[model samples]
Target: MSSPTLDDAKRRSTEKLDPERDVETLELAPASEYYVSHPFMRKLLSWGVEARGILPVPREERTDTQYNRIFFIWLSANFNILSFSAGSLGPAVFGLGLRDSCLVILFFNLLASLLPAYLTTWGPRLGLRQMCLSRYSFGFFGVIVPSIFNLASMCGFCILNAILGGQTLASVSGGNLSWSVGIVIVSVVSLFISFCGLKFLSWYERLAWLPVLLVYVVALGIGGKHLINPPPAEPADARTILTFASTIAGFVITYSPLASDFTTYFKPDVPAWKIFWYSYLGLNIPIISVQCLAAAVVVAVPTVPAWSDGYADGNVGGLIQAMLRPAGGFGQFLTVLMALSVTANVAPTLYSFCLSFQVCMPFLAPVPRYVFSVLATAIIVPLSIVGATRFYSTLTDFLGLIGYWASAYAAVVLMEHVIVRKGRFASYDLRYWDSPRKLPTGLAALGACALACALIVPSMDQVWFVGPIAQKTGDIGFELAFAATAVFYVPLRHLELRFRPMV
Candidate 1:
């Protein structure tokens, strides 16, 4: 109390140290000697050291391992596409009349999926994690804000998936198992597997694709026959086309936050074209196929409504019922297949969520990482059970709200690496996780630009705003939002640089 020495002050701030604790328990190496001696730091590091195997090694050494390349590509391709339920729902909600909707889907896919792969390839070349790399755009400390946002978004989606999976389980079981029970069961399993870390998830990915492929093949085989014979087409409309395009874009962009998480494992030596095509084929092609199939099925089956107020909105059950109409007990078979797909999908969602939350720790504490993963699953599962529909709707809005910031992050990184800094950062600089200075001005400028863009973009399209303005306008909210964010950030970034010196 009289006056804590500088050592004491540093010790308090550094949570990774503990002199009284056994050295074996500390997982991470201390940042400084003071950190090594502090009790809290030691405990955290000890846990991190034990769990280090779970994390991808800093980028340079990772390329030495062959499993890294194969698993990374497979995982990136499979994760979002496997959870095809929502993708299936997109076209049904938006009428299929506008041929241009497909173009929108393709464009958004390139922006959300391809752009991030390119950015993450830089990660391996630089040997850094997503949040660490983000310092180029969001300032050193500022990156934390977006990191937290990304983490929350990932967790929220996990909860949403749990809800969807749970509802599927409940429907398949003829309501013998409530959606709540399904949520708990799936969440617990996902938590256990994810706690084992990336290697287990990678293994899951390899095998999970088999069932996903089977389901798709069966759906297409049976459903394709119906399309060939051709049922009368549903009347297409302009509004429906716009809705379809927007929804598809929203779904693709929402998952863009997880892009670097998968690609970080790719070797720096992997050619850009190889990565791009591999990702495009593995991710987008599969997704578009599923979306188109879903649209076709809903259109063909007039009895099944595309949109519903409850948890039964064009679910896998509906897909099976539509596709396998002539076959007996096919719904049950398809239900099982859907369950398998959901399990595969949930594994990576939880795994990525765990990695994101780990960033909030002082350094690399694995126990807390596992604990948080499980805790997140537990929290999300129950909420999802009671609030599946509500949660999905809320999450959709949240993704739309935050997507502008993510887009800005992507733009800033491209500018810094491709234009201003000319991609000159050292690999070791990323590994060390230290900034050249306490703040990064270029990154701050980017964040400010992003914020301004979000505000102005939302204002232009009255539909995005809730008050009298949105009521006066209509559904043009997203178009206004996207344009506003994009246009402002590029120019403001340049002007801000004129006033401020580089950090």
Candidate 2:
């Protein structure tokens, strides 16, 4: 495979060369060495129908520089029914008042947003997918661990979103449609958007939030008056506070691994501060608003008969339906649209999940990205069908699991970038992304992850297993994981750099 030289880039600009063909050839050639020899396939790729897989996009191929779009991208992805459901968990399950839940949502989500916000800057700077960038610290082989975890997290998230979307459809239909059918419908819609690749996904996400935002406002208007005043009870115990905080953190922090996937097309010169704030404000605004609204509304579940009955029937979907029941047909219509909003949430996850597989399995790297979107949809549709009844349990446990590794993973990667490499973007060799020998040994990363997991186990609060320490202190496991990984990673990375420096 031939890399595009400065001479080649210059020739394309100066001479009468077909710029599209040259760019396509440059980008797709590295996916498979034989691609350079196949004129028919090269022409096909030049048409841009085939989605680019895991290959690092060349700087010349990157033309997007709309930093402001980062705001809408994350806004649409997170401003959905899933976030509303997450907020309801505070009072619905954890037994906290509206004020306490609001506190948890504001404080923890603000702090958690920082990790992924910073990672979003890497997209333009590195021109690699998030998992592809993981090769820097986790090595080509060791990245498979996070890849697998990310894939599972993606699937888990899809299932949760699909189930809720389906339940809402079912709710709107007055139970005429089965929840399974609704799940399949939303999953297919999301798969279609993701199959169109990054450009289409960006376009869809940019506009997707408008209708959903209107619906959220209506739901809040109708239900906001129902929020209990003078508070229900005193703040919960420390264990409960920590457990709920970790749950919310788990919900938002999982985006860290998928952060760079969206920003890869931006021109590398985009300011880091611009990317950070756009991504940060984009992620936090909807999260804080919808979550706080849900939390406040959920406190009415026990006090309001309609809400209580709604929750009893369809979990989060039912509660929302009852909340909006006052608006009559308009309320029902909004409920349906809110359910459909899952596509915005699921599309990006479905898109990035395919990239993760390409990064993890080399054979799959040559396969077009849309094919993996099909594969992921096939897997998620069935799982969502089977897991439809276990919404709350799945939400709590899966989110807690995400909190465990994502925190540790974020800590190690951030430490490697800031402390080990002194936050120097030039230190990254994008050309060596696919080269194992040129990457880190991953001894420090693996060691740090292992140490964090060992500590995480005893502090995790879950349905299946409650660690002894967790029984006493609640789910501080994620915090412990972050602190532990940072402590272990820096020294170990320094040692590895001293002995096994890459050229």
lDDT of each: 0.52, 0.83
| Top lDDT prediction, candidate number | 2
lDDT of 2 by residue, 253-296 (tens): 99999999988889777788999999999999999998998887
Model 1 ranges off by over 4 Å: 1-50, 53-56, 64-83, 98-104, 229-243, 303-318, 321-331, 360-368, 389-402, 435-451, 454-503
lDDT of 1 by residue, 14-62 (tens): 2222232211111223222223434664575555421331232333344
Per-residue lDDT value at 453 in model 1: 55
Give the range where candidate 2 is weakest over 10 consecutive residues by summed lDDT. 15-24
TM-score versus the correct structure, for each prediction: 0.75, 0.91
Q: Give the local distance difference test score of model 1.
A: 0.52
The window of 10 residues in a row where model 1 has the poorest summed lDDT is: 17-26
